[model samples]
Target: MSTELTRNFSIIAHIDHGKTTLSDRLLEFTSTISDRQKQDQLLDAMDLEREKGITIKSHPVAMKYKAKDGKTYNLNLLDTPGHVDFSYEVARSLAACEGAILMIDAAQGVEAQTMANLHLALDQNLLIIPVLNKIDLPAADVDKCKQQLEDILAIPAEDAIPASAKNGIGIEDILEAVVARVPAPVENPDKLLRATVFDSIYDAFRGVVSYVRVFSGSIRKGQRIKLFATGKTYEVKECGVFTPKMTKRDELVAGDVGYFIANMKTADEAKIGDTVTDSTHPCPEALPGYKEIQPMVFSGIYPVDSSDYEALKMAMGKLQINDAAFTFSSESSTALGFGFRCGFLGLLHMEIIQERLRREFNMDVISTYPSVIYQVTKTNGEEEIVDNPTMLPEQQVIQEIREPMVRIFIMIPGDYIGDIMALVMEKRGEVTHTETIDDMRIMLTAELPLAEILIDFNDRMKSMTRGYGSMDYEHCGYRPAKMVKMDIMIASEPVEAFSTIVHRDKAEGYGRALAIRLKDVIPQQLFVVAIQACIGGKIIASERISAMRKNVTAKCYGGDISRKRKLLEKQKKGKEKMKAFGKVNIPQDAFIKVLKSGD
Candidate 1:
């Protein structure tokens, strides 16, 4: 196919804004999928995605569309995730495309993620075709949404196409606009082979299958290709494009998006964002926007059974094949045994990975509370990056500490502005700006510490706004903060897995609540279990679980009152001895339950 006849574009939108539905309709209109095979969210092939009704991964499909001008165009549609946690996936998809369809809900004019993605697309200088979706809904207000597009995005209401992707309304108009408005790829088949590997998947039979967008030259089967970043070379075993499924081809020319399988044993060998080039003819430098993704939240993942340690490691290795954003290092905990200190972009990302491990790998795992990375400087002028609270140095050696911060954007109803502002202030956030989107809704921008909103913030926001508020954030580097390490101890022994770094002002309250919750979850033992929260050997909060009582005087029913009292006194003496010498056995559920306190 000629480069002029190809269109590479992506559908970017907020969560539940009809991106997948729109893609399905496009596939159907172009005859990419037959009517008999049509289904809701056809691009969401994973069961988890179908069940959750959201796209978790970026899906690329090739379609042949016959435009009104009587020309058949090869259209590549990249479907991206809508959640903020997967914003990185959206960035990767945008980097591979020439244009994007910015889909907005007709009822909900503009959301936080929609604005975030729009800014990113503008930054890339990609042609954006603003689309207003879900017009069939009774609540949808097309005119209001169009005005929002005009006022906020500066895209004219006339230019924004209104359509209902569910019923195939204006599907042909979208196709024509994509062909005429979105530019074609700039072909350079004469240059050296240069392709960008946007994504990859592991196949047991074919090794690692990498998805690439050919920018310059052509690649064929049996040709040797080298990754620019890793400097590893492999012979291309097979090459294909997704006709919604892998369809083998003889060769892929410039301006093509497809997959190629090499004899790569591991997915790490061909990293995402790496450049692919012919071994004999290579480019001068790797592609742009290729950098390592740093994780923002850290947690400990341990197997329910200690024997599954090796299995857990194997499962993580397999999971890492497709998801290279998260990182893990082997860690051992006295209370939790062998585990991994895993890092994630956010809470949802962490949850999705854990759920995938359980559903796909059939591994029962326990994840501790999530925390952000901290930069700690010591009195001796040495610095360290602390991801796990237990790894923090002694308080005497610490000189200064810095915590990660994020610039959060929230869009909500005007009625809830006061409540939202109060909530932000409670989380140690400073309001940077506020603007009125319309008479009923407003947009708020605040700078908040990353640690404050890692958990429960979204839920609280939803509750405070009655589910009308939406938020998005990006890391804005770090700021100096007064922090303290809080530790949980049972029977005088510290539980490393339960340690956390907290702001100095809120440490005492958090510690008190944690101790109380631990008391409720821990069962009574032969010896009293003393749950204590401490900071630098100073006890801030404490709770006690009474020991189980034994009927030592049951045998003598009619005995004198003094005899019964004596027996009780003897039992009390025995209990004191047991409390001093015996160890308190804490159940695994206790550890899991304490982590759910939103610490």
Candidate 2:
């Protein structure tokens, strides 16, 4: 197809805003899938995504649509993840498109994430088409949501399309709007070949399959290509486009979206956001807006069976091919054995990776509590990054410590404003501004520590507002804070995996709560198990699990009382000896349960 006949676009929305459902409708309207093969959330592809009703990865598909204007156009659709954790993925997807379809829930109206993504689309200078989905529901207020788009985003109500993606209502109108409004890609087939790699996956039979958007020229089968970022060249074994599935093609031309298979062994060589250009006639400059993704949360992942360490590493290698945002390195703990300290975009990203390792690889793994990275400076004028609390330097040598901060945006009903303010204040947040979106709703902005809200802040906000509140946040550099390292010790030995960085004001309370909770979960051993929380050398909280008692006197009920007393003393002495020499065997589940307590 020629460049003028092609339109590249992406569908973006907040979580549960019907982005996938709308994409499914478009596929059906274009007759891309047979009626027998049609299913709800057809673009999701993964079992976890289907069950969770969320898109974990960005997907691209090409369709041929016959518009009402008697023209057949090639439409390329990119479905992006809606969660805040995957914002980086969304940004990369937008960079590959010339337009975006901004979807909003008709009943929910504009949300925190909606505004965040809208700003990203605007920054990219992409033509945005505002859409209100799920209009068939009786509760859906199309008029009110249209007003929201105007007041919050400055989008005209008439320009917004209201449709029921679930029932295929107004699907034709949306497709027609794409043809009439969205502009076509600029043709440059005569220039040097330059394609942008937006996504990729590993194939056991074919090696790495990279999804690309051709900008300046063409890529044919058997041609040599070089990656602009890595400066590595590879022979293109096969080239094709996604017909919702891989279909081999002779060549992929300019303004086309497709995949190319090269005999590349690993994902690091063909990194996302890299430029692919012809080896013989290379492009002098790479594309702009390429930035490395930084992880916001860090945790330790250990295999339940120590022998599975190698298998775990191999599994991670495969998973990383699809997810470039995740990072890990070798780390060891005396309590947990060999493991990897992994970094993630956010809490949801951390959970999804853990779940995939267990379900897809069939490996049982233990994950420690998530933490934010901190900057620590030494007395000798040296600075280091500390993701794990056990890696923190000694208190005497530390000159200063800084923790990450975020600018948080929240939207909730006016009735619950007081409760939300109280919750944010408790987390050491300061309110910066407030504005009324409508008579019944308001938006609140605050500056909060990243550590305080990385775990349970979203759950708490929903609970306080009766499931009517939504929130989104972005990293806002770092600031100095009064922090301390708190450690948990079992049987007088510190467990490095359980150590964490906490604020000094709440250290005592958090320590007491954690100690009490660990005592209940850890099984009672032959010897009494003492769980203590300490800072530096001072024990702030302690709890004890009494040893299991064996009825030593049951067999001598008819014996003399002195004889029974003698047996009791011997038992007491034996227990004391066990307590002094025996080591406690902590179970795997106990560690998981203890770490999940604070959330």
Candidate 3:
């Protein structure tokens, strides 16, 4: 097909706003899939995504839609994830398209992520097609949704299309609007090949298969391609487009979105956002690549059994190929043994990885508490980035500690604004701005320490607002605070696995709570064990596990009282010796009991 008859666009939205559902409807409407082949969320390939009702990866498909003007257009549709953690996926998809369908729930109105995605689409200068999905429900107020669109996003209310992806309403109107509004690609095909790699996957038998959006020239089988990022060259063995599946295409011209298999032995070479050009006549400049992912959350992942360490290593390697944001390195702890310190974009990303490890690779694993990177400035004018609490230096060496801060936007029902504001203050967050969306809803912008909201802050907000709250955030910067590293010690020895960095003001109460939870799980030995939560040399909180008594005087009831006293005294001396020299064995179950995340 010619470039003039081709349209490239993506469906972007907030979580569960029906991006995937809309994709399914479009694919079916265009006959991209047969009646028997059609199913819900057909674009969501992962089992975890289907089970969770979330889109973890962006899916690309090609369709042939005959418009009302009686012209068949080749449409490249990209369906992007909506959750904040997967915003990176949306950005990647947007880079390859000329337009986006901004999806919003009709009953819910504009949400935090909806605004976040809208800003991303505007940044790319793409044409936006506002869509109010799920309009069939009784609660969906078309007038209110359209008004919110004009008020918050500044998009004209008349342009917003009201449709239900579930019942297939306005499917033809959406397709017709897409063909009329979205512009065709204009890159020259005669120029040297410069294909931008939006995504790629590791195929066991086929090696690395790259998904590319051709910018100039064309790519085909038997062509030699040069990867701009790694400066590696390979001969393309096959090329194909996704009719939702890999169907062979003789050649992919400029403006085409397709996958090509090269002899890329390792996943490291075919990086996403890489520019591919002809090896014999390479493009002078590589296309601008996506910014590198800076992990917002960090945690330690260990195999349940020590012998599965190598297997876990292989599993992580496989996962890293598909997800560029996830990162890990070799680490060890006294309680958990050998493990990898993994970095994730957010809590959801972390959970998805753990789920994938269990379901896909069958790698049973345990993870320690999640943490964020901290900036530590020393007294001698040196600075260090610490993710793990055990890497924190001694109290005497640190000058000031800075923690990551995020600017969070929370939208909730207006009636609970006071209660939600109180919860924010409880988490050491300050409300910066508040705007009423309408008579019923309000949006609150706040600055919060990343660590403070890492665990249960979202849960609390939802409960307080009666499940009418939604939140999205972006990292603003770091701010200096009175931060300290607290350690859990058993019998005077600190366990590296249970160490955490916390605010100084909350250390007392937080430490006491942790110590109490630990006391319940750690088994009692022959000698009394002291569990202490310590900040440097001073203990903030402490708990003790009583020793199990043997009752040595049970067999000497008729003996003299001195005999019983001597036995008791001997036992006490033995217990004292044990307490002084005994090495405490923290059970695996104890680590699981204490370290499992609240999510």
Model 2 Cα lDDT, one tens digit per residue, 182-287: 8898855468898999989888888889999999889999999999888989899999888788888999998889999989878678698999999989988887
| TM-scores of the models, in the order given | 0.97, 0.96, 0.98
- Model 1, residue 422: distance off in Å is 1.1
Candidate 1 global CA lDDT score:
0.90
Clashes by residue pair, model 1: none
lDDT of each: 0.90, 0.90, 0.91
In Å, residue 48's CA in model 3 sits off its true spot by 0.9
Q: In model 1, which regions exceed 4 Å deviation?
A: 557-569, 596-599
- Find the candidate with the highest lDDT and give its number: 3
lDDT, candidate 2, equals 0.90
| Colliding residue pairs in candidate 2 | none
lDDT of 1 by residue, 41-135 (tens): 89998788999888988999999998888899999989999999998888888888999999999988899999999988888889999899989
lDDT score at residue 183, model 1, on the 0-100 scale: 97
Taking the tens digit of each residue's C-alpha lDDT, what string does model 3 give over 44-76? Answer: 999999999999988899999999899999999
By TM-score, the best candidate is 3
Give the least accurate 10-residue stretch of model 2, judged by summed lDDT: 590-599
Q: Which window of 10 residues has the lowest lDDT sum in candidate 1?
A: 590-599
